[model samples]
Target chain A: MQHYRRTEIIVGAFMLTGILAIGLLALQLGKVGGLGEKGYEITATFGDAGGVRNGGDVMLAGVVIGRIKRVTLVKSLKAKLTLEINNGIQLTTDAIASIRTKGIIGERYVRVSQGADEQFLQPGDEFDDTESAINIEDLISKYIFSSGSN
Target chain B: MNGVLNLFGFMGRGLLRTTERIGDGTMLCSRAIGHLFTPPWLGRQLVIQLYAIGFGSLIIIAITGAFTGMVLALQGYYTLAKFGSESLLGSAVALSIIRELGPVLGALMMTGRAGSSITAEIGIMRVTEQLDALEMMAVNPVRQVILPRIIATLIALPLLIAIFDVVGLGAGYLVGVNLLGVNAGAYIGETIAKVTMHDLLTGWVKSAVFGLLIGCICTFLGYRAVPTTEGVAQATTRAVVTASVSILIADYIITSFFL
Candidate 1:
């Protein structure tokens, strides 16, 4: 009976420890851009989202300031991306939204080019100047063939 | 002519014996599954097995996980920095550990730790006539001996994999952020942002299947031990080898299917 009790206690303790560890990790993940807190929302329409995925970072001047909240098709050929920008950073009405690659063959992220216009973008405003990410493989293939033609 | 025929006959008998052993092992696994759900469940036995398999194995798993993470971070930093793309470090380390390393390595470690011990204990019991004694007493040995180990293994393996994932990721962070002076917040943030539910779910699923394989193989090998101490020792060794090979093969199959 004592041996059985000891076994139960040990198993309980081990399971409790595992649960606690996972819980702590989940909490940490939730705090930083996972749950999308304290960020202003904006929209961008693009001919293609390219390889952009939800949870990809939104960057300004090479610094991550927010994340892609959701992606949906606003038209048959146009995709709409909802971005949650970090608070305290205001964007102009003329700000350009472009998809950029971090490294060669790396994942894609949204890059917001700040505009010089004095007018601040209101909530739910959409950026008109958007650039889809350039596919390097496609570019390389095109370059090789096009250069041969020339 | 007679000697040549005898040689062919010997080869055929050997093949037949091997096939018979495999069939018997399969039948044993099926019956063990049936016995697992039937009445008079051995909760106490299962709890003891769980402690032995789970709690006792934590320190080794943690150490191995941490070392693996540190190495991944170090190597990843060197490789990515060469291309001036060190920011992808988090995705590389987290995806590799969570998707592949954590489940497979943790299962292999448990195969060495818990798998060998379970096989030896049951093999010894078989040689000592304890199994026969239980059968004579009308107590189902499968229910008494096999079920607890199987249940404990299935429950314990997932927990072990989870521990490996968490410890390994933490180690990667320590090496990448503190030791190497990468931005701590960004490194962790990227990992969390990139890791999806599918990545974690796939690992846990693999762990569960590996657990079943280890338990069934070990128990089956042990229960069929020959009636001698030497035979019991041989069966125990065979159990570990067979379980390890099956884990590697199954991992490949699972990866191909999922990936």
Candidate 2:
């Protein structure tokens, strides 16, 4: 009887540990970040969004405050990004949203530079200033041609 | 001549035996599954089996996970450093462990540990005529004996895989960030960023399927053993080998669909 009880207790502990492990994976390590329904939406357009993927980070001063919700091509043949920013972080009308790569060949993300304007952009409002991703090949070719010409 | 004809007859019998065995195994799996939800819940039997399978195998699974993660981090650092992207080591370790090694290696280890024992236990019962006695009493041996084991394995294995993944990622963190001097935030952040819910779901599904394979194959092999000591030994051996090979084949097929 004692052995049976011990087995039940041990099994219960094992099951608990397993459940905790799964919860850690789903909640902490997974990308189902709590920004699902609580964030404010804003739009940013760029000539080239580069490899900025959906659910990519939106960083402000190197801190993530939002995620890229969607990426679509506008009628202007440019990229339009829908961003879901956290509720408390406010963006001004003059804030500059730019597509930037993390490392040399790392993932692409949006970096927002805060502007000094007093007016704050509302939900669904567009960022007036947007910078497209830098093409490293274009920069290298231009540098080589200019140096050769010189 | 008569020699050639005898050889052809042997080969034909072998092919027929293989096909018959496959059909019996499939029927065993379906009947056990059907018996799983019927009356006489056998909750105590399930708890005992869970303890035997899940708690019994925890240490070995965790140790395997740790070493696999540590080695993966070391190798990943060596390769990714060549490209100056050593920061991706965490994601490398996490993805490999969560997506493949956690399920495959854990299932393989469980087959050797719990699975072989399951086959051996049932085989011993058969050798002693215990299963036949139960059948004589009008009790379905498949329901009385096999159902608890299959249900316990199905419930225990995915939990074991979850524990394996967690332990593996922790060990990888120790090797990658603390030992290898990779930036701590990047190591952790990249792991969190790169591993999505979809990846977790894939791991869960794979582990569950592997669990089913192990339960059915091991139990079926033991339930149908020749009721002799030597036959029981052979059945145990065959159970481990067949379950391990089936897991690999199923992993490839499941991964193809996911990809």
Candidate 3:
């Protein structure tokens, strides 16, 4: 009976440790997009969103204030990104939402630059001034061609 | 014509035998799971088995996870450095461990450590007529014996895999940041940013399936072992091999759908 009790205690400890490990992974290591949070949705259209993925970061002044909610290719053959920005931050109408890469050859994120306009954009608003991701391949080809012609 | 006929017959028999074993294994799993609902809960037996299987295997899993993470960092650093992107090492190590190695290696290690023991124990029971003794005593041998082992394995494996992943990531951070000169902020940030609920779910699902596979394959081989010491040894070997291979095959199938 004592041996059985000891076994049960050890097993219980093992189970608790496992649960703690799982909790750490899910809470600390895993990323959850802005869902069921105090957030507003805003759309930004870009010519080429490139590597911008859903759940990608939305940075304002180098701080992540939100997440990229979704990425869809609209009928215009352009990428349409829906960003979920936190409640406190406000974006002016002329604010630019641009697809920017981290370092070189890193994951892409949306960077929203503040504008001079005093008027704040409401939820479901679309950014008129959006910049597409810079295609490295295209830049390389252009550089090679221009330099060769010279 | 006779030689060709013999070859065809041998192939057909082998195929049929394989199919028959699969069918028997499925039936055994269903019965064991069914017993889970119909109680006499066997809680004591389950705790005992959980200790034997899960707690016993923890050391091996941790060692494997730590080394795997360290090696991943070492290899990833050198490879990614060639492209001048050593910053991506954190993401590389975390992604590989979380998505692929964590569950698979955890399951494979469990199969070797616990699964072989499970087969041997049951095989010994058969050899000593203990299963028959249980039958004569009006206790269903399958219910009394197999059910708890399967249930314990199913409950244990996912938790072990979770532990494995955490230990591995910690080892990876230690290597990438402390040993090598990768930026700690970028390493951790990329890992946190790139890994989503989807990747975590993928690992959990794979681990659970592997748990089920290990439980069923080990128990089935033991239950069907010939009543001899040599037979028990062979069953133990076969159980480990089969469970390991099945985990890999199932991993590929599950990953295909998730991808």
Candidate 4:
């Protein structure tokens, strides 16, 4: 009986440790996505979003500082994405946000390679200069058709 | 005429026996589960069985999960590298582990390690008339012996899968970043963006069903095994084989529902 109780204690501790580890990993993986975390919103307008998805990461210098909150269509030919960024990081008024793919054929996310400007952008200010994700299928078809025409 | 008649009779007997066993097993599971929800939950037995089943198997689970993850990264890197998309290895590993391998492989490990043991232990008790002794004492043997084990498996299997997922991700990360030279940012970021709660929940639900299947099948086989040493050994083997096969089949059915 005593041995059983000891096993119980050990097992309880083991399970608790495992649960804590999973929780930490889940959060670190950013599955929570700023549900209750403090962040500021910045909207960026793009000529196209292609495969840029909502809840995707907004990265600066290979590090994630925010997530895409929403992707909306304005003027039927362009996309506007609402990005939720952490409070401490400041974006310059002339910063550029571009939709970038994770790999050759992977999900698209927004990367801000150079956001360093003398004048800083505010919460509601939009980053007008943006690059959209290149759809491989579209590019291939366009090439095939143009090559055939020539 | 006698030879042909004997062959036909043998075939008929085999069919009848198969149906009989299936019916008896169904009744055994129903009665055990029907009694499971009642009071007098054997708290001590549950704790003991939980330790025996869960804690006793952590090392094997860790090894299995880590090796599986490492192999996935190695293979996925080579395949994705053809397209210069090796950085997607993280998302690929995470999705595969969370959605398919984690629960299925974890349950298979349990079937081999714990399911066989449960069948043999209960079979030995039956052979020794220990279960009969409890019956004479007016104690519900099913509740005492089976319910706790069922509850233990139900709780332990999902958590085991969760641990498998975490260990798998870590192993994949180590292999991808250190050995394969995939960019670390793309690996982690794509996995976070792709895998969601829905995938995790599907795996958990499958684990629960697998737990119930393993727990009931092992206990029922042991309780009904022929009371002999050879009988107990055969029962143990059968328990493992049956539990493993059923887990795979159930996984397919559940995946179909999700699709």
Candidate 5:
């Protein structure tokens, strides 16, 4: 019984520690994405989502300001993404929503390039100026390989 | 012709035996799980098992996690620096550790460290007729022994994975920044900036599932130990092997499901 008691305490402590660690990680992730209160929601449509999944970061100027909330196909060809953007950061109607890679061939994230316009994008408004993710390798390969054939 | 016929006969028998064992193992797992929720829950035994599974395995997990991270960083820098894309190393290390290395390696390590012990301990009890004695006393062996171990494993595995992630990420940072001359602030900042809740959560879910499987495999193998001492040793070996293989196979299944 004593031996069992000792083992149980140790395992419980370890389990608790793990749960706490995950909690801390969640907090850090939240802080990084500016999740929770003070974030606004916006929607965008794209012909192709290009590996952009829900919870992918929404970046402004290469810095993450929000996260993707949900992704669904509005039509057979068009995909709609609901983004949670941080408060106080306004985006103009002309803002371009481009799916960008963090590094070369890295995970895909949505990047919003703020447009020079006075009209701020309201909640639930779809951004029309959107670009799908560019595969740099494909572009380069096409350029190098196709240029020779031509 | 006789020799070839003999070889084929041996192969067929071996295959049949393997299939029978797998079927029995599956049945045992179902029984254990079914028994788990049934009455006569041994809360005290559960606690003790948790301590053994969780606390006893920490140091090994930490060491492995840290070194794996450090090695990944070192290797990542060496490869990426050549292409002038050293900046990508942070994301590479973070994604690799979070997505694949963290859960799989952590579970594998635990399979060796904790799984073997669980098998041996249970095997010893079975051989000594302690399990039978409990049965004779009208105590539910599954509840008193196997349940605690299974519950402990399910609880402990994720904790080990969490420790691994933190330690591994930290070690990777150290190697990337201090040893490899990458910008410490940039690496840390990029990692924090890029990592999402989904990535971390997915890793945790995988670890938890793996933990449960490991616990089940080890405890089941241990519980099925025969009366002979040799059977106990064989059961221990089988537990370790089964747990490790299952962890790898499950990793693939979980990855496909999540990604």
Candidate 6:
């Protein structure tokens, strides 16, 4: 009986470890645990949004630094995308955004390339140097039809 | 030509015996399920079995969970590095463990540990005439002996697999972040972004079905074993083998439906 009681206590400890790990994992794995990091939103205008979808990643130098919040089409055949960046990420006013696909056939995300400038972009500022996704199909057809016409 | 004919004959009888055993096992399980609701709840026995199965199996499950996570982290890091996208390792490890490995491996371990013992224990009782004696004394052995174990397994395995998932994910974190120097935020953030409630529920559902498979097959085989020493031994082996095969087949079928 005493042994079983002790076993139960140890089992209880195991359960506690599991519960605490779950709490930590969930926090780390959910809500994008910013803890002290407050995010700020910025907008970018692109000729084409390509495959960059909402909730897609905003990456800088191969590291995910933020998420694409919303994508809307502009009347001038441009795409306007809203990005929410992590706290402490500073972007220059001349920085450029490009919608890069993962591979030949993969989802697209916005990659931010930094530029040398004394001026830094503030929250809600719009980036002017953005490239839309170059439609692969458009590129292929242009190559195929023009070459076949030869 | 004669040898080939003999081989076919042997296989034909083996298949026949296998189907016959399947029929008998089905009847055993249905009868036990029928007795499940008819009072004489065997509450104390259920508690005892739960302690024996759940508590007794914790250390192994924890160790397995940790190592599985660590191995996944190491393998995933190298694979993702090839693509220069090591940040996605967290999602890979989490999805694999939560959707498949945690439940399936945890149930397999439980079957090898607790289910095998349940078979041997009950098989020995049958060999020693204990079950027959209970019947002579007007005690329902299925209600008293089998139901408690089935109920205990049904309750215990989900808890065990949930622990396995949590601990495994933590181990992956330790290896990926502290050991390999992946950014903690990126590792965890990617996992959280990609994983959903559907993944979590799929693991739990698989564990529950595996628990039922282990409990029913093991207990039924043990209770129905012949009253002989060899019979008890064969029953134990058959219980483990049958329960494992059934768990895997059921896993594929259930995952197909989910997909």
Enumerate the candidates' DockQ scores in order.
Answer: 0.42, 0.58, 0.61, 0.34, 0.40, 0.21
Q: How much lDDT does candidate 3 score?
A: 0.91
lDDT of 1 by residue, B92-170 (tens): 7888888899988999999999998999999989888899899999998988898889888888888888888889998
Model 1, residue B6: what's the lDDT? Answer: 100
In TM-score terms, which candidate is top? 3
Worst 10 residues of 2 chain A by lDDT: A29-38
lDDT of 1 at B128: 81
Question: Predictions ranked by DockQ, top down?
Answer: 3, 2, 1, 5, 4, 6
Report the lDDT tens digits of candidate 2 across residue range B11-125.
Answer: 9999999899989999988998897677877788788889998999999999999998999999999999987888789889999999999999999999999999999999999
Q: What residue runs in model 6 are displaced by over 4 Å at the alpha carbon?
A: A1-99, A102-107, A110-132, A136-150, B1-13
lDDT of 5 at B189: 59
Check candidate 6 and list the clashing pairs: none
TM-score of chain A of 5: 0.73
Per-residue C-alpha lDDT of model 4 across residues B52-129, encoded as one tens digit per residue: 888777778888899889999999998988887776788899889988998899899989888899999999999999
Q: Tell me which of candidates 1 and 4 scores higher on DockQ.
A: 1
Q: Candidate 2 at residue B218, lDDT?
A: 97
Count clashes in each candidate, considering only residues at least 3 apart in sequence or on different chains. 0, 0, 0, 0, 6, 0
lDDT of 5 at B150: 79
Candidate 1 error regions (>4 Å): A24-43, A48-50, A69-93, A103-106, A116-125, A135-150, B1-23
Report clash pairs, candidate 1: none
TM accuracy, model 3: 0.92
Candidate 5 TM-score, C-alpha based:
0.80
Error of 3 at B135 (Å): 0.9
lDDT of each: 0.85, 0.91, 0.91, 0.84, 0.83, 0.85
lDDT by residue (A1-150, candidate 1, tens digit) is 887787788899999887766555455543434554677789999886887988899999988888898999874878899998888889989999998887776778999999999998877889979998787888999999999999
Error of 2 at B114 (Å): 0.7
| Root mean square deviation (Cα) for candidate 5 | 4.3
